[model samples]
Target: MSVDEIIEYLRTLPKGTVVRVLVMDKASGHLWSSIVENVVDGDVWCREDVGTLIEDKDKKPTPENIDRVLAAVPGGLSAFGDWLTQEGWDILRDIYDDAIDALR
Candidate 1:
């Protein structure tokens, strides 16, 4: 999906939905995960958990870092499949499939 498609899909979700996403640091090949606590006006607000790669390493993982990592990812949100765990992917897939089916 394109960025616009992702934004549109997110808009369809209920507020305060918990959605996990993988974030990668292009320079270090380091990866982290965040849980999106809410989506507002095409912007996703995430919670950086203690187990996040950067956070676990005692590094300060700021909101800017999350945004930068997301921006650096190729193919935008569509590329999330490469990083999501099976359970995470399944959750997202179910949501996407349900949303698509609802339109029929």
Candidate 2:
């Protein structure tokens, strides 16, 4: 669905309703990976997953691995203290529009 569709659908849900949002880094690639993240700012959060994947084990690619990450996902936000951007902030600003304004 489009961004507008997602926003409209979310608004229909009751307050405090549980929802899962997955942001994947790779669009097309081999089957892979686990996600480990920290910082819990609100009721919405993911489970703790410090475990390793069998395919990812012993496959720690350096240098090039870092380059691959920088290329694929260029925008990010860290909500620990405040809202910020890496790049293409306008994309989010336009997509979220005023819905994110009340978040401030």
Please give each candidate's TM-score: 0.30, 0.28
| CA deviation > 4 Å runs, candidate 1 | 1-51, 82-104
lDDT of each: 0.60, 0.46
Pick by lDDT: which candidate is best?
Answer: 1
Q: Name the runs in model 2 displaced over 4 angstroms.
A: 26-104
Pairs with steric clashes in candidate 2 = none
Q: Would you give me the overall lDDT of model 2? A: 0.46
Query: Against the true structure, candidate 1 has what lDDT?
Result: 0.60
